[model samples]
Target chain A: MYTKLALLIFIFMSKLSASVVTTLPEFAWIVHNLNPDTKVINLLQGNEDPHFVDASPSFVFKVAKAKLLIKNGMQLEMGWLPVVTQQSGNEAVQLGGKGHCDASQNVNKVGVIANYDRSMGDVHPVGNPHYTLSLVEMKSVIKTIAKCMERVGLEYSKDKYTELLAKFDAQIANVKKLLKPIKMKKFMVYHTEFNYFLRDFDLISVGSLEEVPGVLPSAVYLAKTAKKAMDEKVSLVLASNVSPERYLNKFKDISSINYVKAQMHPLSSDDYLKHYENFINELVDNVSL
Target chain B: MRLILLMFLLVTSAFAQNNNLQLINWFAGADIVASGDNLDQGADKENHLNDGMLVREFEFSAVSQIDQTWQGILTLAYHNELQAEEEHLEVHEAMLFSSKLLPMANVKIGKFFLGFGRLNRFHRHDWIFTEAPLVQKSFFGNEGVKDTGFEYTRLLGGALNWKLTVGLTSGGEFKHGEAHEEEGEEEHDHGGNPAPYEPTRYLRASNFIEFSTIEGIESGVSYVERRDGEGTRSSYAGLDLIYKKRVNQYIDRLVQFEVWQRTTKEMGEESFQDLGAYLYFEKGLNRHHGLGLRFDFYLPADLEEEEDHDEHGHSSIDGITPMSNYHAISLSYNYYNSEFMRTRFTLEHHNGVDVEEEEESFQRAHLQFVFNIGAHPAHVY
Candidate 1:
């Protein structure tokens, strides 16, 4: 009976461990691309907003036992991760520590809006925090993840990270070359989050439909924006699929302006190249006018 | 007053006459609250009975753009305080705000609430609870809602997400109750001086002299001096900074710091300084929950010299004793029910400093329900 109870406990622990790693997108990506035997227990899905997440009570339990912790640095997770680390007493994930990684470190930032001001709307003041959209930057982030994987003494395919990086580079370069011939550089967007991607492809952001972050434009504000779009002869009204449609409806009269939805968040799938290819193709199709 | 109302009606009617002006949207909402307090034994503790009261608040706001470069907002509020059988009504906030005065800057002017502290800038109706933090309530007061002032905000740099703001303000504090001669009667009767008491008879409504001495009334008062008119000479200046960043795609962090100073020339004495500073950090673990930590410090210039007691033996200084230094740590669980409602449970620890030796540390648990009646996307800069 004693031996049977011990075996049951061992099985429970392994199952729990597998669930924890699979919950996070980055870890899931790592597991998908590098190790089939490794189990991810509980990683966050990409559909959720990361800024205001609830660190589940079980997270402390997981982090307390975790051998490796991966995160996006640059003060992004400062709100809840620190508390989790502290509660779990995990020094590995502490700031500036070995288990920590900032995917942005070596990533190539693109389409950074020049002279972007906070007063313009809810715009990213920094060059662009959304560097994940660029295949080149995504490759850098993957390399950083691979380094973390190595630190944990996990046996990962030696060339997997490198192979992924090369593939993304070639694919992104081709897209960049293809987009180079487009003459329409100026576009309007509902939000300013796309600055990095647009700048990389030489797109010019003329204005946005929303007056500020999280706020819809008042009628008067919308009218002025519509007038400005007409005045500037902008060709595209870029937006997000998740955003409200009322604000973009005003641009319908402008035949040249086409509404395009762009994804700004990361995805859970490990197929980064497939996602980028589809995204870029959609963007090109929308602006083909 | 009737004519003013008539003129307002005419202007609104004319505005409505233009179908184009009718395109603007408007929203309104309110909350009801009940509160009770227990005061420790003290010389003035007798008046601090366990009190219960109800308050109803109403607000209306509109946003519109003037041409492509300018955006405007107009908001007005009304509040009614009811205690037992009595009810009182007052204007809460009335103001106009404009953005894009320049390509990268926004300006807010008129009688509007100033964003001196994080809590001060948040609309009361949107608060998690009916009451504000005790420190904020005691220092700023009810109807500390708005000041007649102008503020300018600018966003600088995109990669760094740095933001800055500067403001100039006309300071006139508002208090609940009708301003009248009867309000001064307590001071005049206690002094038994008819000459000083005489001013009460002719005092205009809401224009009672503030310095009148009543034997034991502990009134929270702030003085604003204006060079050109009553309450006009007092001036205030402020600065604010905000920094935010996303860590990977799952975590977000924000840091906000602010400092403000106000100066007023006393009727017959020296000018005094009212200084305040605040720092706060918020982290978003994911989209629905966050944790916040905050520190605040305030210093009032005219501390009564315990030795300088008047013949009548009353404290002359009108402000609450400075908090000197205060800090709060909060763990918040936010449930985004929808675009219009959010519920948050915050466990907060408050530490107070530099008060009477007998005062103890202040702490409490706050569960807040935030009702976002409307949202204009947050200006991210």
Candidate 2:
């Protein structure tokens, strides 16, 4: 009798549920808000470094069960995504398959190092993979996700995704209004992760803490950077919490530059826009035009 | 020398300025080895070319996504050791892959490394250690197996994340001195006759699964059957396992193990059974630094004697002496200067297989530096 009930419940659940896997939580956030009913599985946590995600078996099983898999391409997911996909052996989510989605396909990429090499410290040959940092770039990625969902035969309706996108545009415009006063502002970041965010905000970055992409700055390089930041009146020191900041710390107390750790992605925000709002609020609190 | 350098620069400039494609990579590397052998480690007696500090390896590589469905990789290499008379262009690997074969499968063709063991497919410049492991040197002939071949990969259905692969090649030619030490210089190692070409068959199944809740494991099994039609018939089987734990955001602790066994049948002779195994441990202290240890045990297959005795041969515990087994232990520390440059220091202790008396193990040390420049494709984890 219990077995019959279990089978009945299984059938019911299977009909009502569909699973979606995303390499990054930013993509997960978009998919979750689009279809509240679907099971959205995020492979990488919000604060985790996207480049070095270990292809754990649990995550592989998640990909195995997923009908669709979305990833931030441009070699951002190159380290492990191919390995996971191949191991999952899920034909549906394999490259060139209908259910596979590369969010970078339609977006305009910045920081594209043309003649690439390891000299650039783990740079993406195609371009930087941090597109979701900017709300403007996120729109393009979101649109691509929607088209992919339709192409892959996800249950989520096109009209509903379109509506969510419209709401996101409005949310972005509101943030822009708040950030308008700081428009064309100058700031300095420890890493180049904030390039797209600054590009969208019309802000300027004079120098970075690390002279090369991932190498730690030498004392001489730091001194020179501090001078450059001061001459340009760079007001904010932007960096992720995990990025070491001893070099940036030197200039903080001596100069007017204020250090603020930016959120990698949504930590506990209930919605996508709120995540951006939290980061924007932190940015505005530290810097003035 | 000046003319050659100028010609290389001219070719590189042409590659960089092309409009249709501009992604070109150049890897220039050299091995500076300081070795004044305190105890003979079986290298000098054979008169191998691997002694002393040497500048070698100038290679050019490129990977192009031809269109939506096709991708190609081409690498041409020049080795100073092999270019004794004249500089010869060696095509290391030229591969073309098709993702449109089937929704559930992919196909690749051309000359490439056979995807068997975890470390076999890695380039020399990308190795975790300065030298090849004992089993790889003995079974794969110093340079890990590569051949002009076609392969098909299919994703299997399971929660374990399994994949099935099958391939065929002209032959899994163990090209000696083409890359590293085990050039199989002694013709008598293969009974004084080595067939130029043969048919080879390969099959492998692998999976990456969770070892525990947090730690992960990758494991695989492979079988290869080889034949030259004249005298020898062989079948090789291998088992590989890897366990890794993420220590923090920047570091990983890893352990890898592999075992290989084979059966060989020679003309008018009985088949012999042989086996080998290795264990490797690596700790990533951070992104820029790492420590590693590797231990190897090999019981090589006995071969028909064409000459009285050659360099390397099979040893059996049940035979004259169980001490004939090869044993090696290596410890290394690595400094990843950046993505483009790296330096490694290694100290190894090994019982020389060619040494008749196995009382004392030889000590060997190496310091190697390697660097790459321009559009190198990202290595797969």
Candidate 3:
């Protein structure tokens, strides 16, 4: 009886130690790879748009118990994550707390506006937050996440993070080489979510179907975008799984440009590297020089 | 080379400090309404929903993480009082909050919306409908329960997502009794007592559970009590439920239901109880459009009937229609232009049951325009 009680206590104590929570599944996948021993919880489990998370009670429950919290930052999770973390009453993961990690701290950013207002639509003040679409930018976030793990006293292999960063660098190089033939292909996107990915591969984005970030474009704006695509000889119209399909079909019907919808963000799966490789293969398979 | 390196370090540190100082944010919002009612005769104070347009409410707010351990929120509002034919500026909320003061607890101090019923805590602009439901308007007045208070919320992390909140408030601004007027109180009289406020205490326990991958439900129980210096006491108990079904990213469904019971007793009078309830349902057609419906019901305590009868043989209660039971149904269509703006059109029908005969029924139509600018954090789910 004494031994059994001791074992139960040990199990409870182990459960209370250094659990991590991330706002996005991609971050969780990276954390699990870097620290296999740490128990990680992901707030977004499906293809729900990161911009409009529900901040449900289950998310608060997970955040309340986590010792460390990670977010993509740069206002990507601005609408929901702050309220969940605040309601969690977990000081360790609150804004200025030692266990809080913003993965966009040192990333290379694009689409930063010096002076902005609501008239410009839902634009981030700290630049575009879709840097996760680029593996090169994600290397910087991996370093930030690793530092946060160390601060939380979680056991993580430094060599693993370094190896992961090197692997990302190699993949980025190889993809760029494979897509060299279509480096300057002009394309239009449903949303600006793929700006970082296009920038990484040296592709030219003529315009977007959505003039404003989250709002559907007016017919006048759509006509102008289509005319611009036709004039620029745009190769393809790019979209994501989260983009509105009906509007994409409307734009395709008007512009006569076929769209290739990709999954820029990873789902709740451990094989995130496969997602990246599959995305690269889809681009090569769809676009022509 | 070493001096240049030192200067670069100094510049970087200064830049970081400047960024920290910019964390304080200020935002503003406005709600304008164009309303029309068919009621021929009513006092302005009794029914403030007029047949004209008005800038119903305008608010400015500031929020800041004061430091690593404290956060502050301040909101000021200017609203047109159609009853008084003037615009009044009011402080909606000014509070300092901290989560680091205690383990698994969040503390808030200063004036704020009381931690009570589900709809009571949300600001009018955040509500789905343009006007308060009949039950909410009768029990908590148009704005719902807001007071100067200290609130402590405890996050009891468990499988059921349990949370508890307790608040003690100075109820100087507590307002009620518009629809269910007290005895001897004249019509067109506004409510809410001034200074020397009575002390109000409230407690609420909330729990949430996910039934499936796409369905989530949250339920809460709340209780509040207040004692006036004049020996009048009031107590309220409430239950609220919110359910959400996420069919897709653009299409979802929401159902909200609430029931409240209030008991009031004077120094020498027998206690009287009032019951109120509301059920709301909304279906999202897509990202931009939604349809919503709400049903409201309120039953007031017993009233004494006057001995005299009118020429039409209709009984009278204090020379007025005895609206013992009241219910209303509202249907609304909402258009979300973007994250910053929304337009809503609402149609409502109000019916009352009299002790002897059927009280008059009325219809109302309202169009509301709500817009926000600057930096405003989204409200919690």
Write model 1 residue lDDT over A1-289, tens digit each, in one string.
9999888877756654542243346545654576656555434556444444444434444554455666654434444565454434444544444655456667665434667543454344344555656555666777777677677666678677667667777897888876765546668888655666676677777887877764566788877887888788776777765455655765555343678776544466545566667777777777745
Instruction: Give the candidate order by descending DockQ.
Output: 3, 2, 1
Q: Which of the CAPRI classes, incorrect, acceptable, medium or high, describes model 1?
A: incorrect
- Which rank order by TM-score, best down to worst? 3, 2, 1
The sequence of per-residue lDDT tens digits that candidate 3 reaches over residues B1-381 is 224335534644574477553676767899999988766564322443557889988887778877777888877776773323555555678899887788678898998888778888788888878887766765676666777879999987555778999999876656532222233443221243334336889999999987643478999999999866455677899999988886444437899998999887666777777788999999989878999999988776664533221211111211223347777899999997877789999998877765555565778888999999777776677
How should the candidates be ordered by lDDT, best one leading?
3, 2, 1
Share of the reference A-B contacts seen in candidate 2:
0.19
lDDT (tens digit, per residue) of candidate 2 on B147-218: 788988776745466778898976635433332323333222121235533667888898867654337787
The lDDT per prediction is 0.49, 0.68, 0.76
Candidates 1 and 3 compared by DockQ, better number: 3
* Model 1 Cα lDDT, one tens digit per residue, B261-369: 6665434556656566656667766545566666655554454433221221111111124324544455555554444555555554545442342332433343445
DockQ per candidate, 2 decimals: 0.02, 0.26, 0.38
Off by over 4 Å in 3: A1-18, B1-23, B41-48, B82-85, B176-198, B211-215, B246-251, B305-322, B354-358
- For candidate 3, the docking band is acceptable
Q: What share of the true interface contacts does each candidate keep?
A: 0.00, 0.19, 0.48
Model with the higher DockQ, candidate 1 or 2: 2
Cα deviation of B315, candidate 3, in Å: 20
What clash count does candidate 1 reach?
63
Runs in model 1 lying further than 4 Å from the true structure: A1-27, A35-37, A58-62, A108-127, A177-185, A250-256, B1-127, B131-381
Which is the winner by DockQ between candidate 2 and candidate 3?
A: 3
